[model samples]
Target: MDTDAILALLDGQYLLILGAVLLIIALVAIIKLRGSVHQLGQEHDQLTRRLDTLWHDLDAMHQDDTPSLSGKSKAPTTSATPDTSPELLLAERRLFEGLWPVAWALHDKVGGFLRAVESGDPHSESRLAARNAALEMRSQINRSRPFFDAEIEGILTQLVDIEIKAHLTACQYLDQRQSNLGVSSEGSDVRESYRNKWRQLYDREANELINHLVSAMRKRLVRHVP
Candidate 1:
């Protein structure tokens, strides 16, 4: 072939090769882009599901805070009964609102402390928090004594006592466990078993007491509704 013709042929081949390389690069980029888009879509779906779960949890909490009254519905009474006077009812409602959060706080704190003890690494922060919660609960009850009837007040006292006992028992368990960390003896096993039994018993009792307290409070509130 002529020199110019040969050079022209080589240039055409080079252009074809460059175009092929560019095409492959574009295809690879497209594939990678598709993968990134798919990954983002999956992440978006996961986040949306998490948000939905959070919303559901919040709604459930709201429902728990404001329980509906069960059974008989009577017409609103025209005159204020001595016990159900508007002022007294308002005060009782406020007390209920104030006490509810503190009660649950104490319950959660004690429960957390017990769980931490069971896990064999009870955090000091958890213990202190539980103790403070108990004290706060007692103080709150005492402060609101005027709003509570004798029955409710008694229930509150019982709840506080049981919670304190549970907290103390948990602390003792942790202390014993720490003191005997390297020891392995039959007596140790027996003591461990005994502690476990008491812990379980206290936890069960506390749960029951909390349920009873809640039911009593609900009934008290419902009773005075005009």
Candidate 2:
């Protein structure tokens, strides 16, 4: 072949090689991008589910207007005559009215946290709302600190710990689930391990702790005559 013709043929071969390399690079980029898009879709779907669950929980709490934890549905009516001892009367009123509602509020708060777990929704706002309500109840107890002695305070502290632990457990479970889902190579055994830890350790421990607090509180309150 002539010199110019040989050089032209070499140029054509170089162009073909370069085109192949570019095509391979484009395919790899597309694959990576598709995987990312799929991941984003999954994340969006999970968030949407969480939001829906939170809305449902809020609706349920709003609907349940009946008093909880209190033994009676309505307060007993008294004669028009007022009590002679104002202090005793106030204590009596608090025993009947304040304490029961506070207990019920705590119960409701726990129930809400459990429901959020059942729903598998970690909507921050819903969890925050429940936490804030629990805090308010805690504040009320603190304000009435003198009424409850050392033993009562200890039980209340235990109850607060239970509440805080429940929230932490739920958040940890959600985080683990999300992390497991993000990794493509994660094995079923790892997921199962997470489940076991949550069920056997986190949940069982929290349940036992809360039950202990409830029993302690009941025992302490039982001794009070007023």
Candidate 3:
């Protein structure tokens, strides 16, 4: 085959791989969302069963004049916050997993805009949307960081920092593009910077943290199931 044909084939393969990744991210988002709902349902069912058993025990105790021991669980602790519930923690982990899909989608949007600018179209609405999404995701991370363990929080803070930088570059690029002024010379550099950030988030730093959290959460969550 000629060199040109080989290059074209390689490009096609690269695109196929990227498409597969995007599809996987979309599926993950759906699965994690479902997992959160399912865990909630399980916890709710357990709570109802426990309540019913307590009521029955109370009735029997009244008739027999004996103490009730219907529930096998420990007495209530001072902290009844959802934070202490295993099901809620699992749901929280799944919910945290759900955020990455949005981050990946925003990565894709920024990538597309980078390509457009490279082809001389200047940055477009897509990049602006990506910037906004990154900002919103950062806000979400802030609200959620406290719920997680310290290790996870450390990874998340880094992710938020990257988001801030990426968004600032995007904002500046869009402003320059909208003015009659041509695309800035720094556009290529910023594009490269975001590409690195994407890799760090999905393939390296954030990926490792996600695996750890998932493993820890699953173990604890199973113990709480009725």
Candidate 4:
């Protein structure tokens, strides 16, 4: 072949090689981009699922209105044909009225924390509020006991257990939050372990408390049945 023809052939080969390299680079970039998109979709799915679970739990709490702790629906009447003494009826009313706010406060605080967990609020303010509310609830229950009958007092005592659980759960949550922050050279696995532990603890205690509040049913507190 002529020298000019050989040079032209070499240039063509070089162009082919350069095109192949560019094609390979483009394919690699596309593969990496696809992997990142897939990862993001998975993360989105997880977040949606977490939110759905949180809503389901919270909705369940809102659906139930009846209290569970009452021995029976037997509040004294106020008619001329009195079922119980005026003072006794007043005491029962007081117990019911006092407990109304406590149940709501528990629900609100518990719901707050669960939402916080879903939202990834590391400070966990909802759990902290729940802790303080629970302590205050115990105090209120104690202070109001003097006016309540012995049977009523027993029902209120169950709430004390729930309150203590709330307090302890709050402490665990605070610890977990700080530990997860990694100011102390914590590893990813260790932080993840603590996070999972705190989430499970909060869910269990919070759900338990919600169920227990059914014991403080409004119907039992008031006299609606003839």
Number of the candidate with higher lDDT, 1 or 2? 1
Using lDDT as the measure, name the better of candidate 1 and candidate 4: 1
Poorest lDDT segment (10 consecutive residues) of candidate 1: 69-78
lDDT of 1 by residue, 42-115 (tens): 99999899757644543433233222323111122232223767687778878888888998898898788777
Q: TM-score of each candidate?
A: 0.58, 0.45, 0.39, 0.44
RMSD (Cα, Å) for all candidates, in order, is 15.1, 12.7, 28.1, 13.6
* Overall lDDT per candidate, in order of appearance: 0.68, 0.56, 0.54, 0.56
Cα deviation of 176, candidate 2, in Å: 3.2
Tens-digit lDDT track of model 2 for 1-226: 8999999999999999999999999999999999999999999999999767754554343233212322111221222333336675457445535655665566566557656665766666666766666566566666776664444444444444445445545555566567756365464445455445445433554455446545544654453445
Clashes of 3: 0
Off by over 4 Å in 4: 1-83, 122-128, 180-226
Model 3 C-alpha lDDT per residue in residues 1-226, reported as the tens digit of each score: 9999999999999999999999999999999999999999999999899757644543332233222223121121222324447667667668657665655554556556555554667564765665555556555656776565544444444443443344444445444555554355575556556555554434454345445544544544454556
lDDT of 4 at 220: 43
Per-residue lDDT value at 20 in model 3:
100
The better candidate by TM-score, 1 or 4, is 1
Top lDDT prediction, candidate number? 1
- Which ten-residue region of model 2 has the weakest summed lDDT? 69-78
